[model samples]
Target: MTLETDDRAEAQPTARPSRLARVRAGLPRTGLAALCGALLALSFPSFGIWPLSIVAVTGLALLTYRRTLKQAAWTGIVFGGVFMFWLLIWIDVIGYDAWVLLALAEAAFVMLMAMGQAAVSRLPAWPLWTACLWVTQEWARDRVPLGGLPWGRLAFANTSSPFTPLAALGGAPLVTFAVALSGALLAAAILALRARGRRAGVACAAGAVALGVVGYAVPLPTGGDTAGGPASAEIALIQGNVPHAGMDFLGRPMQVLGNHVAATEALMAKVGEGKLPQPQLVIWPENSSDVDPYVTPEAYQLIDGAAKQAGVPILVGALVDGPDATHVMNEGIVWDPKTGPGAHYTKQHLVPFGEYVPFRSFLSQYISELKRVAVDFSPGDKTGVLQVGPAKIGDVICFEVAYDGIVRDAVTKGGRVIVIQTNNATYEHTDQPDQQFAMSRLRAVEHGRSVVIAATSGISAVIAPNGSVIERTQLATQAELEANVPLRDGLTLADRVGATPEWALALLGLAACGFAVWQRRRQPK
Candidate 1:
């Protein structure tokens, strides 16, 4: 052969490997992370497939594996950006700018989680440590600057999954741990399958399958489970449709109040006609009476009339011109048919910007949204265990249900059943209500209490002790959900354990990171 032919032949021999190298190059880290995030977002409410969460976490683990902390953080940011962007899209109803800002803020937490994940990624059974790290990250996220937004938690998404039983064992934190662990286990399975050892691959596959089987066998308490102490109370949940969608509901305050009052009266008429059983307690959604019943005589009379008609104690949600004129109190008032408003539970966890502007002195000048709030809503200093008729209901207003501690406190303080009073009028037909409903389901299992939700713009629901939806109303529809909810006085293991499992899991994650660092230092320079 000639010299020219020989050179061409040499180049041809190297062509296949170069092509193979190009093909073997994986997707960009951020791209993979974003894909993982999108998958995870799909696992939550409104698009709840649940199993997708495991796959998403597995994909994220692979992307993060052996990556530097900086790279892992970037991966987390991309992942969170995609996930939060989709999960919190309902916030766009308020403003696109606000939604984007909130998503970015939440993504920062994910970045922190990814950094910690990178630290322990080198450890043995790294998936287990990584899973614990997830719990820790969530734990931190749930309570940070301005008492973190607990929306989009893993436990909330797994409310209807086979893994929901785990909540009874260790509360939402445990459920979150189980989800992260399963995802990590799945990642391990994938890793093992790709390894050279056939036996390792088989073992991991078997282990993962076995765990899933075990999860199904977990003895979750059902509706048939006895309350043992508190008797079952017939409850009514009112979801009076708003006059108009969006913030317009705020403008027609009296119209909103009239709607709830009318719904309650209609429910009473059903009872009078022997079409429906008389409820021991009638619950109204938050902002059911935007005008303070205590201060506004007409509003008070409207609520009183409804209670009298039902001939039952009515739990009315009211926005009261508070102890100070510059602020208001979002309250759940216990109104007796015989008497007026008595013991009330003021909302403990107020929405940061929606209710009150944080750093108001500075933010008010720059952001027009602050002006919309007008007056701040004050946070109550106590738990929301309310005495209504024969039962004590744990009343959490609107966004308070997202906070684990708030719900748990009421149960601990002798709330036999959980009640969530919310006004989703602004977010009607959005994923917002669906997501909140998911939290109620998880809380039901966590505390082993029947949860009754009263929403102003529908999605009102009665969740069983086992996290099953007994009954739920449609979005933006005028409806009432009535059920003989078992008043569960008994506390599940989750209630008793409180934050221990979360703290322990967090410690394990930190220990793994410490060990990883020590091992790295011990290695040859």
Candidate 2:
């Protein structure tokens, strides 16, 4: 009887061992997903290992392959949470809680994206669907609760990569699609290879290589006079160092304003001595004058003096008290040497919570930090295409550069050049400056116009139409950059198409997800 029982036990399968194996299998995927997130973060500026972005995307595609909805969602959380936490670590300067909450909220979008990715993984041309989903996620995230934060985009990582020229074709969305598609194709190649499908693997691999190198074939006008005429403008960018680094970088009431005035005066002095060519217009960074020039006489006098000294128009970024007592305006004012503050562009996209609290009456009761922003900032009704001197330039203030619509509006509305006025004193010495600068480079190529960035506490640059840096300033330095940038009136295909590619690609992704669900339902139980 004992021998018979032993024989039966030996023949029976062990349920515990099988369950253990399943659990062990899940751990590696989770670990790898986390690693993928970290790698993606490193692909961004400061760390800037561009190829890592493609690798991370490939790993994510493989992780979600054949995964259940629940499994895919969990993998996304692991990946997105890790990625955002590291990418926005600079937010910790505000508060650790704020950083965590923002990271969690951003990761939620990625979690949903992962669910869609998993759903579509079974479809034919799954790699294409996956790439579209990436664009869809960015589209949603770019405009949502509080004008969604558009940081950590895949296109931003490829600003200087071979895929950069693709920006001129369909803007940032197309570049993102190319990168994501390449990574997905790599994943497909890997899967086929492991399955011993040599022909399929080779085909997928070739497809990825083709996508990666095809950008070089695209024509990008980086030469003189992109407008088909001998038209160019001499521009100057001013980087006025702050008194100190942090939220209080402005220091004394007129300290920040004085720094900018001093820098402008120094540049003018150089021009006076014939050390440099006279600029047609000079661009100052956002918050170069924290106090409203209209409300404060001292600030007005200082700015007026600097503009007159330059003997040209100075695009000065300032906080102007306005529309109401409770609201302020962040504006880029054209201060001509003859006429003080002629035309101005009010910043359209205001930074939520930083510029204004969303639910002041309710949230302020719980979070006392909201008290710091005593007054709210109002949004502008029009695009920032203003005539500065002889050039019609588009002015995007600080974080506004990250928004595709804002930047595209300027170009489509007859902006000859692009100007980015930023103040990075609060986030100085962090990856934020480098990331913003990368966006400027991409914008140059996207619109086929010269991009001039003026940043307080540094990273001022002059970017060519082809995304080359003609001049750049270091962080926390008081410096001036002069460049003869070409004036391009003709818009790229991206400018003409606007958000069509993004919307179409996003819709396709959603359709794939729906079809995937329908397919699963049609299957037998």
Candidate 3:
């Protein structure tokens, strides 16, 4: 242990590192980590597919390939940062600068997962840390800031993947967990294949693949529409195709309402001429009449006239002020041919900055140039279930369908059918319609309820209870799509049990993670 001996030790590499370690050490560093985040965000779009995901997971694996907990955390933040930065692009244009808070919040949640993987690996048998962390992160994202934003959960990418059967088993959270687990397992196998215990790694990777295969193979609940009495109900969705500027409807309320009315009239004429079947319910997009129906007599008459002409129970989207004058309720009024404004379902879930500002007065300056839409609509109550004679129509106005719990609660409490009363005028040309359309599809599957999307601008659809897009309208089209949406009398296993499965899995994964952490701490150092 002389100074000369120590100098010699420092000069000579102790033992030339193995090839696998050499590969890890010799890997070049680049801003590829940031690119991984971008591609991962892009994966949220339709046809994003597995290739982008492989790039993301591989990049994530590289981020952790040879890093410590601190380094992993920094890299994970980089991963989350590029991700949220891209995810929030709509938020900035849609102007909830407050979304910066949500992005930061979610990035921190991802860091927790990074820490979980970094700290818990010293144990003999480790749980899928990446998978567990991913599920937990999704749950967290959808839980924070007024019950959470369930928008960018990983399972969203698997909407079209065969792994969708996992949704029926435990909703999208389970699917997300399986996908991430498989990807991480694959990455581990690649690393392990180049090392000593490659066989076990291959087996682990195989097990993950088996879970995915089994997910696809399993038969999900089909207690939906079948050979039942009066199984189908005809419904029509009117896509008004309003301008990208949200309040454009108010300027041309006549044209907006005229567009929908003209479309409905033509559709019903087709039904009369035996060209198309009659719809029991004719639906219009949110803000098809943003004129205050409750407070304005003239407005109610206008809507009532339209409903009478349509010859069906109509759902009219309108802006109405509350009784107290302190707030306004973004609402959809149920109007019958005989009675006008029969029953009303108000929007429960409020947009953080869009419909109503979080700190309304303070943040008005940022979005003032685009019309005062953020302050126009009022927050609706959850108990607002539309009473359509013997049938119950569960309605979610604007962005409420984006929330799993909101839609679930509606169906659980007595809503047999779900309607998305959305005004997509704020996001006309972007990928918002497709993203929102995918969300409705996932909800249809998760809740065992049919969904009718009445988008103001375009991409309105009729989605069955099992996530199938039964029919949909083309983008930026002024038209109505009529479909016999099979009415589901029963709820899904997920609707009945709520997030019970997710919570149980989370606890189990967390316990395994905690145990792994404990064993790691106690290991001989």
> What TM-score, computed on C-alpha atoms, does each candidate reach?
0.92, 0.95, 0.87
Candidate 1 deviant stretches above 4 angstroms? 1-27, 223-230
Best by TM-score: 2
Best by lDDT: 2
lDDT of 3 by residue, 1-525 (tens): 010112234446578789798556433332566777777888886445544664576567645653456756766787778887677656655555555766787777766666666554433444376667677767777777766777777777777666666776677777777777777677667656656577877797787678668866655433345432345577888886654454344455556766677777777788889988767888888878766776667667777777787778888887777745667777778889896777787787777656655655655666563345534456565655676543476888766777667777787877777888887766665566677787777777777778888987777888877677778887767777888776666766767778886776666667766876676467554
- Per-prediction count of colliding residue pairs? 0, 0, 2
lDDT (CA) per prediction: 0.82, 0.90, 0.69
lDDT of 1 by residue, 1-525 (tens): 010112244335453556555434433556678888999999998999898987887788777776667767888898988999999998877778779988999888888778777777777788888888888878877887688988878888888887888888888878787778778777777676665666766766665555455556666566533454546889999987787778667555578889888898888889889988989889999989878877778888888888888888989989988778788999999999998789999998888878888888887787666677778888899898888998888989988889888988999888988999998878876888888888889898888888999988878998888788889988878998788998877788888988899899988887887887788678654
> Roughly what TM-score does model 3 have, to 2 decimal places?
0.87
Off by over 4 Å in 2: 1-25, 224-230
Candidate 1 structure, TM-score to reference: 0.92
lDDT of 1: 0.82
Candidate ranking under lDDT, highest first, comes to 2, 1, 3
Model 3 misplaced regions, further than 4 Å: 1-30, 95-102, 124-127, 220-229, 244-250, 253-255, 364-378, 383-385, 509-525
